[model samples]
Target: MSNQEKFVVSRIIPAPSHIECVSGGMFKLADGCPITVISPLAEAELSATLHDTCNVYWKATPSFSFQAGGEGIAADGYRLRVTAEHCEITASGLSGIRNAFKTMRQLAESERGVLKSTCWLLPPVAVEDEPALAFRGIHLCWFPETPTWEIEKNIRLAAYYKFNYAVIESWGMIRLESHPEYCWDEFAVDKKEVSRLVKLAASLGLTLIPQLNLFGHATSSRCGSGKQMLLDRHPEYASLFEPDGWTWCIANPCARQYLTELVTELHDLFDKPPFFHIGCDEAYNAGSCSLCRENYPAKLKAHLMYFYSLFAKRGARVMMWHDMLLNRDDPRWEGYTAYGHSSRGLDELYKELPKDIIICDWQYGYPEKDGKEPDWRTSHFFKQTGFDVLVCPWLERRGIKSLGCLAKQEKLFGILETTWHWYRGSFRKETLFVIASNAAWHPDWTPESNVVYREYLNRHLREMDQDMKSKKYIQFGSVQYQINPAPYQD
Candidate 1:
């Protein structure tokens, strides 16, 4: 056989056109690395998986060579060898890429090609595939009200895509204020809900970071509950600021005490190691409080420093949102979780924060915008700052073409895809998982490019059925909403 021609299955089976379109087939390399092979057979399996998984449109065609590592293989349980050379992985169809991904998991971490319930694969596949940033995480819908099994399902899905971090926001388990089951006390019967997920994430090598809205966001606070409503009654507790006819008073002593207690209470809820996300965003209405206004900048700094110190004392690190600096008035303020925002907002804060703080730059690009969508400038800036960075993409956003295959090949630090309960029907977990596995090997890929995606699909189908060819036109739609209030709705 030629150097390029290692092996090919002689017996081929036929699959549906759609199946042949999205996937080709996967190959177990000599080094045990899973490589994608494009052909008719692979596509059949891909269509089968997608038909069994989601309602999305996909098209795959063409034969392409994509692999993610040096030639690797395993002879038995006792003998394993992988070359130190960089790995190369390629696939045409989206499904083809996904099957290859599963194969990788089986090769890298699993024995007997069987994966435990909660399992995934990280890096070191290729020497050059190092993340540009250290900290990467999902920022929304982290705290879901769904059954524990579903939440755990989502967790595994996230890990399978090779994402290492996720934010458990305050939306799940506890209903927001005034919605319905609003318990006046900060009690939690579902506190144990996170136990299984926490253990599962740990086992999968993913971090589950807890996030709670600390000052502001009284949407959960009511008129009767004195603590939940903040110190609006005291007026002394609000922040001091005037932006477009509004001033938030952060000087209020009552507010400080309230936040302190809230943080302490949340800390006790988790059974795992203590890393917390203190949401300090949208404090525009703060600082105007009596005591906060007196020392404004100094006090704001003090407040953040004090809180961070508290968490540090407990052997935990605190992450705060970096939006407050956009005020233009609070230029001196620098403490936050990470410099996170869309690609458009990155350059504005590049020079402001400490180098130690990481940045999470996000973008949800589609075919209309170009398949290889992402703000490359942000990546360059993050590299320049010597700070860590991660990419957060909205895979299911409306009006955006889903380019699962293309995104996986990008040079990004890590991929963070979201699944909000409110927008649950957007994309299937299957689609997200396939794309995420693509990201694990290639972080800086652009979705607008179809060359790689098409190749991946072809390979996947070829593996499942040999008597299939390129096909097109699989349609799926996703609906997304802006958080802004509508004129006709509440």
Candidate 2:
């Protein structure tokens, strides 16, 4: 094959920032050949990942070398060079080295099918890569119906794509030891499972941030589902939430104490991450209770500040949704999803909120005018108000790209791609994950064809299955079943 063809064969997702062909023939890896890693950083995880993904063993001697530092290498950046007989990786830290090996794993797997005499042929190439946004993250929701294996798969895939953080929101899926009624009986995940997942994510260089719906989503269930996870089991606890169970009755001191305990337990279960997500979205009934209505926004502001102090005491900053901070009737946010109502004084909370709390502004649609890029006014508003902002996008490709581009251009904190309920189905193979990853890694990435991206995704999943030693069909595929069961007749 021509040199350009060989280079194209080694392409990987979230494509590296810089890559070029090198003067060398194809690098060959025989079936029994042992790869070697030379580096100051810990090599166990890197070695294991390479073996799992590329089916190559590692030795102590030669072939692969990792240099400690390199010019222009960022904390999470790496430079990789692959020649006919050897590979060299240069990075500044463990994260950079991990990222470099991740890239190399993909490159080797890309040419796994081009084997001759049981030897894989990889193209000679050089790559210098780093994420465009510092905080490349994905927000995953674990529901009662979601399987533990599925959650594990999502976490592994996010790390595989080089996402640095994963915000895990459990919708009544975590079995809180202190408050057993908070989760469903049969589906609740125990502490052991939670710890396993957390350690798995950490081992893969991915941070798992814990999330609890402190204000809204008090039922721990979607509003439309007509289910209240806690109240449905313990009717006596109804007084802690709004009459409809849509939001916590923050005015109640007992309710505050309950939430505090829950937060403390869940936070500790997650190993007390650097950031805690206090879901403060869709609280349409936030101050509807008589006691809460007495002072309205003052009480609301105090409620938020209470948790801010709670988490701060634990050495963690808070993250909350931005819907309630922006006025819904404002002309500037006419087409956006702003839930703040001026009549209730919720529209001005932004002015009083602490600057350290990261505002997660979720814009799920293409809000830009025709032929123009999105202005991301909401994110800019938060930043202008002196608060760090994380632009959140869900499922929409245009919105993901637009918000990601805005985050990069404005130098905002980063992008958090939310995959609510969609992560459980065929959407796993959809372009959303790849697109979001690429958007966070390289905002200016050229969109690849869906077919081509799908191939990359499939190969990644296959490699993951191999690493996991999965035996069942449900372990790795677009869908768990070939056909959908008839409604109520499984």
Candidate 3:
């Protein structure tokens, strides 16, 4: 056996470190060996996955023994050691223990036919592991009538790999009681569905953050995810400018009031995690309204602060898409939707907006670096401009080594892997999710070989696919055709 073969080999996602094969012989389980748990969260987790994970169903002798003495464990770290008599796991935190069970469940896979048979063997080894980044997450863009089972499947896959958070970029999914006219019935899901999703995610230790599209991105036509019903019903709410500025009239108090009510409704409904993502990207028609027309620059700044304050007052940590305030010095910014226009001044947005609000910097393409669109200097500028930056990427496929590199820098909260097109389903995303999940968990990982990474990702995905098949999930995604709008502006 090779020197590396001495360590226990794990097909577990987000691979662990400091692995060692203490015994060459396979460790067999004795009947009714107790699992010692130092955390209550671990207990609940073990109960949830115990049945489905392992083929053998040996009932534990005792429930739990809570005491803490895990010295080297990170925030969400674990230490596991398996031997002949008993297998034990120790972690400093509840999440760590939950994670340890996931690996153990994989390790306990047995080829033995009987449930009571203790023939399954994971080599006796001691392993110590923890995540590199505090925030490891994936982003899902929502379309009209997203199935509840579909949502559950996505969340289940993320949790299985130990990914911590999921951001659903859906302004049209859930029905808001205050504005029934704003969302179409086909697109709007029931409150009960949302509740079920919340509970399901919490059970898996994953936090679901709903992105509320507030200011801008509103139109009565095709080619946009903006809330158009509000504008169709109330044309006065439309922005002041021309050239089809698909944005709300930020100058209008009624528009602001309308969004405020919506925000309040969302706050009262879920109210867990206390974080809100206010979609303020691509507001090309900033000063388009009558009230906001005069002193456009000042009004833009005021509106920025005003919208930000609405959430800040509710004691919710605010998050916003940073394209509107993009500071790319490169010429490639022209093609970008958020570039130069007859709109509000973005030159001073980073300076004017509050420092606490997280800047979700999403760069879909423009792969050039150095002096390119958002090079090192540009990223440093955002950091210096007093913002907690999150490196967002349209990671439909392929690992984002650039974002991973940026994540190592200061002032960066973490990385956000965005799947912009709802139609573009799990095919590419499954592969990307594995890479993003690994990148987030292990910040110091070297992207030495794509072949190795693909193999590692495939192994974890194969196991997940089996789970999905067993659960009888309809394994398919349809392509949603884009609407071709009339050439005329609304």
**Candidate number of the best lDDT:** 2
Q: Itemize residue pairs with steric clashes in candidate 3.
A: 6-21, 132-441, 240-288, 240-289, 241-288
RMSD of 3: 6.0
lDDT of 3 by residue, 1-490 (tens): 3434522353456667556667556555433454555543444555545443333222323233445467567877898887765567788766787688677655554546676754455567787888766777777765654555556667766776777878776546678888776665666777777777777777666888767766555542334444464454555544432235476656667767877787787666665455778777766655655666688667667766776777677777778887767634545454332442433456566677778988777766545556553353444556888787777766533336556557765637787777665323434654456666666776555433223444544444455455545344244332122333455547
Candidate 1 per-residue lDDT over residues 1-490, each given as its tens digit: 2221111110000100111111122222223333234332354555454332211112222133333332222110011112332223334334334433433333332124565422222223221122222333454454323443345545654544445676776542543322223222233235455565676675454678776655434433322333332233333333422221132233555545655665565565554355677665544345444444454555556666667677777777665544543433333222212222322233244364445443444444432335444334433445466754444455643211122222233433444554444433323432344344344433333343222333333343322222122132221112123343577595
Which scores greater on lDDT, model 2 or model 3? 2
Q: Which candidate has the highest TM-score of all?
A: 2
- The residue ranges of model 3 lying beyond 4 angstroms of the native Cα positions read 1-10, 27-31, 38-66, 106-108, 112-121, 219-245, 327-343, 369-375, 396-399, 422-427, 446-473, 476-490
Cα lDDT listed for each candidate: 0.40, 0.80, 0.62
Distance (Å) between predicted and true CA of 143, model 2? Answer: 0.8
lDDT of 2 by residue, 140-199 (tens): 999987788888888888898899999999998998877888898989889999999999
